[model samples]
Target chain A: MAKHSFSLSPLSSFILPRGDTLFYLIALFSILSLLIHHLSPVSAESRHFEGFDADEIDDFGDSDEPISAAKHIPPPPPTTTLSVSDPIESHHGPPPPSADPTSQVTSQPSDPKPASTSFEVWDEDEFEGIPQSPPSDSPLITESDTAASAESDPSLKLEPESEPESPKSISSYTVEIVCVSFLIMFVINYFTGKKENEKLALAWASKFATKDSIFDKNFSLLGVGETDDSPLLLKEGQNVFKFYASGRRFCQGLLATMELKSRHDLISRLYNMVVPCKDEITFEVYMNDDAMDHVVVAVAKKKLAKTMQKETTDLQRFASLVSPPSGKKWIAEELAVVAESKEVAGDMLNETVLDQVFGDKAYEKFGKGFISMHFSDQHLGSHKKMLVFKFALPDAKNMADMTRLVALVPYYIDLIGRYKLSSHARTKTDGARMKVAQEIYKELQNARQEALQRKKAEQRKKGEEAEAKLSAEALRKKEAKERARQMKKAMPKMKMTRTG
Target chain B: MSSPANDPRQPSTAKPYKPSPVAPQDLPIDYSGFIAVICGVFGAMFRYKICSWLAIIFSAQSLANMRNMENDLKQISMAMMFGIMGLMTNYLGVGPRGSKKT
Candidate 1:
């Protein structure tokens, strides 16, 4: 096989050697890390907020006074731990009343220790100090001072809030890793697959190129090397019609149009005639690439003739044979009336005249530039089949093309027969009943011999009369010879006297 | 020489041609994928926690099946992404009664 110089670049060579497994491994690892990050519970500094029930929040919202007011308030300062520790005094103190009368009303009536404890964790410094209960007298004064101080300095507490957002950063990083790995794997698979496919295609192209084999006639035919987009030109003078190629599909289509008992028999017969065991035959429909004019026929086989016949009959049962009877009758009457008028003028109503004046009638049934021919059993009795071919011409009416096609039909039949015989021979089944091909050949031989004997008998009949005439003429010639001999003897005496 | 498998009692005809031009009611629909898409929609639009969880599970199962499928990876991945987004919408309470509205 010829070698192609196609090659990958050095960069691709480096990556190609690593193979796709490595990329998949990386992707697998990335997915695993993402899963771990999503599934595993990291110790979130902001706390899991365990026991923070939605129902409890709903209950709080419904409680009306303190809870509704608390829902509006921002989370209290970390220093609120001091205020919470001094809860006994703070709840009753003037600061609570000044802060919100509603909070004092609800907090004073309900237990306030748990709510204050929940708010104490806002600052790490206060979280440790929470264990140590300080004196309420000093803490109460400091708590009020710190609340005012904390309100003035909220930025000092922002550090703890930022610390709890670590999990968000990790999740974003995991998302980025998963996306990048997925992209990398996708690109590697796509390009690697594409490259391998291209290499395989190149290998196949090289093999076909080296072998000088025809993949299909649509690609190349005759001596005309196909340009990428050049049109085929088949003309009469430069190139003649010949067999180009054949295959199963062509034979199947051809067989479909023929009135054969079974597809099996038709195929077997065609196999015998064309290439043995091959089901199609391709005749060169074009002459040469440069030919200005050529004829091509594309045979499109429809349903089997038997099925078509059944369908047509079924359709006929639905209505009269002359469908739309009134309109058809009117058209027939018009044609007849026109015919009468032409006849009265002694003008001819022949096909040529009608075709010239009223356009071709054949075209009305078969469509424009079409000719239909039916091959009867007499022509194809060897196969015991009939075929109808509808030929569409591209040019003016030419009988020569039809004649050529008819001439080729017998050759195809004979070719199919030979093909079948060869196949049967290969199978070594000579004991099988004589095939149609052998029968046809025997009949042809017998007919030829009979015709030869008949010609010889007529020649013999004429030869007998010629023989009798020749015999009588010979007898007369003998008599003339005897008479001449006697006259010669008598003449010798007269000669002697004359000489003396 | 006929076998019992070709018994006369059975219907003689083979199965009707699939992919026929006539009624194609036999065509299989991906019910799992359909459910997932519905759940995803409900979760995103209404922030229904149950719907979001259902969508997540269905989409995960679909994604697992898609690994075995030789084609349409991109489409299945997009569905998985939508499922993820729906889950997030429910988790973050991003709906008509979400934190933003409050």
Candidate 2:
């Protein structure tokens, strides 16, 4: 390798050693000077050649070393081993899907290279403009060892070797420059771009409403919810809303819709999905950095569908019930309530009657206009098992949170379910079942309420009965004594009258 | 090829040719100088960490009285400020051989 580095070494070897050393010293100082030049600083530094001193310059000049140390380097992308990797499905430069453990797809990794550095065999005819081979099988110069004479120039023809020193560098200045440039360019290309979370947020917003493709010729989004069987609807008059045109939320039109079953379900899903703390939190917790944020869009879709179905039915009922029949409107209204609530029972398992009937309107009114919409506060006897509707006063912010403080909605809904079980404890309406539910609620409230007082009054009734029994016994004894005294007085009066 | 012999053993027949100064040539330089040059180049980079670490240790009074000083220079921010100061000191003004600041 050392013999092969230089072409001029042999021609210069015949010169006097003393004179040769002078030329060598010039080369050495040239390299040391370049070294000092290289260390000054990278970018906008103020100093220039300030690190150089007299002794350093003299020391560099004294050495008889070569100035031809600049090595040859390959072009930009020093060794661009490009192999067209399989073009996997990409959504605008697909995420380096490796980071997302839940995601299945992967970014096409660059072509793999053998993880070793060793001698590479090149084809004999591969060197383009090189020399001819010598007589005794000079083609296969397997190793670096070369002892050919002046008549032969091995590969590139003209050069004969001289130095018997180790090859410290590749010694090709052009190649070195090209390789360094390539490496620097590669490093620069690795860094300027959008963060991963931003891209995910945009993609998620796009896929929020419809299950559609981001980019592809071969694509289809299959609808999963609407099938042969539909879930039970549990609300009478819920308006449906949908998000469309990616990131643009407007109430301009009705495109798709459904009604929610248990309001508790919405709150439950929210609690389950969002990391819960002292209080239930919203999506704004992560804010812009919400990459793992999966929007609970399926719940919204179902609620909207329910709303559309109810509105169409209501329109028909309103027209029919308007004829001569007076009670017809009331009947139609009742049927709508039942049908809407039945929608809930159709889907949910271990179905509770209280949630199906009043879950939709539990937090509805301030207990005005529609009192039966919630059963948690009222005694079961007066309200009975039925679905009710509130006028949806003041237009609650979303489908559920105005009158419905989302935090309080579920507990009230759960209480209604418990209230139903306690109210139905008895087959007959002996008031015991209702009475028990009232007792439980009073216990839950820990307040001296009317319902609690009523139970206390019932308890006092038993005590009064026991007291009355004791008083009756005492009164009988007093009456007997009075009768005996009267009899004695009457007998005395009769005797005295006879004597007279 | 046109040079005459300088010896006068037989007959001094020709003019002696002065040997052209042996052509100024190059020699191989080792990798040690390149290594030294890179070390010197990067030695300036380590000062940032040193100054920042030292600021945390020495100037604790300013750090302790951070809340009272409303000028936004405190432990955390001051450490970062010191780093920038060190880097600027290295870049612009020459001080001691390895001084963080001039």
Candidate 3:
């Protein structure tokens, strides 16, 4: 006997290690750069007002004041007093302007400037007493004096410029903080959510598909190159697992897939919370063509039965809603049936099955978890005949409780494979299928005929278009040739030379 | 019950069933992976940061959950490439309005 080795090396081999590592490194670099860009001092300072610089302000003051000073009074005395007072006031009164500059500037800009000489005289007196006053008292008097001076003097504009910039810088700082926090939150959610989804899938597989389990007993868990101990439930994708069953009598094989919700994605998780959905396990068994008689039957939850009938191709073509026999309810009140005829429904939902479904233990407790089951020998796809069962998966802890439901798969496979439709019911289904086949045939014939006619018409139109494009002489010659041919055909048959 | 060798009525051979391999044409199409690629391209062309991010996430989801490696790899790779391109262009490229204000 060949040795059986079981490992997840095959699964890991599919991952591109270098690609993933490079991708993560690039992502990390981009994120770090984004954070640095936002929090950097250069970006913070850019938010400040850029309209005017101190030199420009000084240039404006120097250029404008001399014109006024030259016109109003002798420039030398005021220049000397202004130069001497400017430095002292700036040093002594800078704190006052910084503290309450906005209010004073707003008030001072409104006040009328009576005389430039008066402002100069007041500045000189204020500078002389500046050192004697306390620091706190100086700001109030200094602000008022500056505001008054600013109205007469242009150089004082620099103090108010810094005021507006403070508010802008603070607002930008708050925005940067918000962006950094959001990036961190997104990264954290992504990794944690991914781990949570993987754990859920692993837990479900461990609980239901161990060695010597029902699945292992019935199905061939080992694939072509896999070992005896290889995991029975193959993880095909993040939320999907597949188990293959072969060596069955009637069906080719059963492909069972467990499809879980997208819990790893934060947005999808939130959406699922708002609109509830379930994780489902689906079993698709393709039966051999001759294994079953002509039949299409589906049993589903009452709410989904209508939709199943509408959407499924075979159900839409051959089956209709089958109400329960005379007085008794369906297999369960919650269940609905759609079948080709009442006879097949009876055969499918017989007394034993009905009793088990209605019994207190299995279906009654986990009834809602039963989604739908469909059987059709006339299915439309590549595998024409199939049996499909879909059930909502319960949580990992309660996985064992659904054993009864899972057992139904093998039981139904055998039962349905051996089932033979009565002669009368078989004829009715055959007639219905024959009628549909004829309808499809007629539709195909009509389409082919239409295409042929369209092609011929297109050829004729192209010939006429070519004729229209000819020169006048060519048109005349073509018409004459047509006339001659008609004349030759129209001429009477002559046998006068052989009359003798 | 009569012995089968003596009776000569029952069939002698019994063959175990082995299922035929699934054909490539029968595999289900990966619709989510296709959608991810489309979103990725639109994100890159339009410079929509949100769309770019969504494309990256969707690509990862598709890649992690793929069923058939041969069938799904091309689509997953295309989606991932476009997603990365979109992110790089939207973040590292100059603003859609031109250079940033000095």
Q: What TM-score against the true chain A does chain A of each candidate get?
A: 0.20, 0.14, 0.65
TM-score of 1: 0.22
The residue-by-residue lDDT of candidate 1 on A214-296, one tens digit each, is 22311222111123222111111111111111121112112111111112222223345665421111222111112211111
Off by over 4 Å in 1: A1-164, A167-176, A209-211, A214-500, B1-102
Clash count of each predicted structure: 9, 25, 1
Give the candidate order by descending DockQ: 3, 1, 2
lDDT of each: 0.34, 0.29, 0.64
Q: Which candidate number maximizes DockQ?
A: 3
> A29, model 2: CA deviation in Å?
46
Listed in order, each prediction's TM-score against the native is 0.22, 0.17, 0.63
Candidate 3 overall Cα lDDT vs. reference? 0.64
**Candidate 3 C-alpha lDDT tens digits along A262-377:** 66555566779999889888988788788878879999877799998999888999999988788654577777899999999988877656655533353687565788899998
DockQ for all models: 0.03, 0.01, 0.11
lDDT of 2 by residue, A248-318 (tens): 11101111112211122222224446754221111111111111111110011223324533443321221
DockQ pick, better of 1 and 2:
1
Residue runs of model 3 more than 4 Å from their true location after superposition: A1-210, A220-231, A327-329, A358-362, A491-500, B1-102
Q: How does model 1 score on DockQ?
A: 0.03
Better candidate by TM-score, 1 or 3: 3
Best by lDDT: 3
